[model samples]
Target chain A: MSSTREIDALIDMMAKLPGLGPRSARRAVLHLIRKRALLLTPLADLMQTVAVTARECLNCGNVGTSDICDICTSEKRANGELCVVEDVADLWAMERSGVFKGRYHVLGGTLSALDAIGPQELRIPRLIDRVSTENITEVILALNATIDGQTTAHYIADQLDGQVTLTSLAQGVPIGGELDYLDDGTITAAMRARKSL
Target chain B: MSSTREIDALIDMMAKLPGLGPRSARRAVLHLIRKRALLLTPLADLMQTVAVTARECLNCGNVGTSDICDICTSEKRANGELCVVEDVADLWAMERSGVFKGRYHVLGGTLSALDAIGPQELRIPRLIDRVSTENITEVILALNATIDGQTTAHYIADQLDGQVTLTSLAQGVPIGGELDYLDDGTITAAMRARKSL
Candidate 1:
């Protein structure tokens, strides 16, 4: 607030970010101003570039710079399997692990009756189309374990009943999880689905 | 990383900001991409403008769009009282509170022995000159409560001992702070400086 209107406006916009509040926004603005050449200028340039070029992948609903995403177009990716996630962020998370070599189907969001979001609101139709046209043999539901997420997974499974082999992510103790710290549902799931050691 | 190069780069730069980790930065970048028209474009434009216009006030060391800040040029503010802080952020914090109606002197940073930073590294010399030239009657040290902050305050106090009245912000329990969560030093200070009920 002591700075000019432009600086204050920058702080206000930065504060609206997911994890950044007013306090951290101020710190970030100060840091950006101090490291203008190394951070601010480049950040501004990239933001502008992304603002102009970024678009949703028409085939999978994933965000990218082209009409079709890299994963959808890459011939190296496993074509028989498709990983379905509720959001583009989840798809990115799976990619970061470098485990799943197959392409992804971004649902855009989970089904929510309260919010009036159904199969039509998301990319369910597109996902079904990709499965048949892209020769997908298996559909892996990588949705979160939330109630709405499970509801969405079930709905998708019903829609694709006999068309493909469907599976959801395992629900159990996380890696490096402490038994005492885990919730009751997690502990029960972990115990019920105990694997052979 | 599944996103485009520019988006991934933006997320990387955002992760470097204070209080934002890689996960949150990814979320923020996605949100910006989704709301490009409403948030991203304006933010980029404003950042570019601030990058070019923001500068240190010649007299006060405050970050502003002009050589001399608005506060420094304002005759309405109390001229006899000068508040000194370690950074422009602190000056902005004071301004947000809207408590002190006086000009400020930003020290840039504290006197850090480990970093070999002394009075010359900060705006201590400028402060001394301003005290005499500006006819300052009182100098309030609004530096942080850290060890280095106290050391810098002592150094400044010594320099202006006889010339002007010197004072520093009080240290103790903060407003709305619970006694159970307060540290030993804070409790001791509060008890020593206890006031009549």
Candidate 2:
């Protein structure tokens, strides 16, 4: 607030971002000012470009620069398997791991009765269409382990019960996770799904 | 990384911001993309404007759009007391509190022996020049409570020993601070400066 209206406005907007608060926004604005040429200008330009170009892929609901995302168009990724995620962020996390070569279907969100979000609200119809039209053999539910996520997964599984091979992400102890730090549910799940090691 | 190059680049830049990490950056970028018209476009435009117009005040070193900041040029703020701070952010912080009515001098940094920074490295010389020129009655040292900050304060105090009335901020337990949670040094300082209420 000590700075000009523009600077104050910038700080206010920056503070609205996911991880930034008032203090951090002030620091970021100061940093951007100090590194104007090296960071601020380029960041502005890129944000403008993204503002104009970024869009959701019509085919899979994933965000991209085109009507259909790169994953949908890439021939290598069309391997008769589809990974269903609740949000684009989850899809990006999967991509970062580079473990899945199959295409993705962003559900947008889970079915929530409290919010009145049903299967029709998300990309469920599009996913069902893609499964038959795209020759998908396996449908991997990569949704979160939350209650809503589980309910949504169950709904999707029931929809494609006999149509294709359906699976969900294994619920067990995470890699590099300590047993003592895990919650009771996670410990019980890990114990129930014990490996032959 | 599943997003376009432009999107990826934006996430990377956003991650470098003070409070945001990779996950939060991705979420911010996604949010920006979704609210392009309402938030992203305007934020980008404002950033560009700030990048072009923002500058440090010639006299007080506060960041503003003019040679001298609004605080420095305001006729109402010509109160003879000058507050000295380690950075522009500190000046902003003071302004946000709306407590001080006088002007400010940003030191840019503290005098550090390890960093080879001295009085000349900061705006100490300029501050000394401004004291007589501006007819300053009092100089308040509003630096941090770090070792380097105290060292810098002592250095400044010695430099302007007899020229003007010099004072530093009082050290004590903060308002609503829990005694049990407070460190020994703070408790001791609070005891020494105990007020009769």
Candidate 3:
């Protein structure tokens, strides 16, 4: 029996998910139907709410529902330190550890020559501005171990040399490992053992 | 520098995401702010569109934009075979392989006695009804290899014992390995080598 167009549309959208495809999308849609009240309804409601309210923080380049993010506004997080990361996923990883007490600066992406991405494409300039304005004394580069990540780190360091203490997460993260893959404990250890760049 | 209530509320919701926490949620919100036009605007628009249009297929339980799913409505897919799976993720995995020509049936979940989930909790009864009414000649179970998955499969088998040709994906899927984790080639091989139940 052929599925309806609406179901196909949902499957098509689900197939676009990071790890799902058409078949899995179909199954997921089905599961949601079977558990309409318990799972599907809630999921749909949350998705709708997020769709309307979700926005990016203007100051920190984070995804939220307002102009400024919570971290950027929290006085308790202004401990003279700032953590820098290539992606929001990295920032999330650090937060999951519940160790760091400082603010954050999301660079959006790394500098990749092949992809024609440079400092102008990332939020490097904005990061520099945050250091002085936020009274940050130390900046932690919690980037991935990929070549582009290191390149971005060095570039940022050059821009902020002699201005603030620049450091990076120490050895613990495997080579080429993305911060999103590392467990919370490993991220914490790396953050604690960070070395000056 | 406390964030506005709106920003805080957004962060709180983001924190509930599968892999995010309060800190990361805050950072993500900030990043979206910096790239409002390029990333945030488009993302927000897509989220809103999906929220308004997304629904489930009335016949096959697939998520979509209308009452019936595309696959269920497509005349070309009216093959006599129906492949049953445990989740939407599983169905998408199968579709990604581009092998199976028949349609699908999403069971939503397994028959778990511990969780007090029974056949009624799933779409088993609807599946049986569809089999006879849709002129289905074969039913292929492509559930995971977990204990609960097997139990669910057995129950389904008993439900349609002599009504149609009952079969299952071959024993190629690793133990406890979800179909979503398997590659397209593996899914295709398993489907091609399905065995009689």
**Highest lDDT: which candidate?**
2
Error of 2 at A179 (Å): 1.3
lDDT of 3 by residue, A1-197 (tens): 22344445554654544444555555555555555555544555454455457665678776655678778888998899999998766776787778899988988899988999988998988998889898999999999977789898898999899999999887677779899999987788788877799
Clashes of each: 0, 0, 49
TM-score of each: 0.98, 0.98, 0.58
DockQ of each: 0.83, 0.84, 0.15
User: How do the candidates rank by lDDT, highest first?
Assistant: 2, 1, 3
lDDT of 1 by residue, A1-197 (tens): 55788998999999998898999999999999999989999999989999999999988888999998988889998569999999999999899899998999999999999999989999999888888888889999999999999999999999999999998888898899888899999999888998997
Winner of 2 and 3 under DockQ: 2
Model 1 residue B111 CA deviation (Å) reads 0.7
Q: Which CAPRI tier for candidate 2? A: high
lDDT winner, 1 or 3:
1
lDDT of 2 at A34: 90
Worst 10 residues of 1 chain B by lDDT: B1-10
> Could you tell me the lDDT of residue B135 within candidate 1?
82
The TM-score that candidate 2 achieves is 0.98
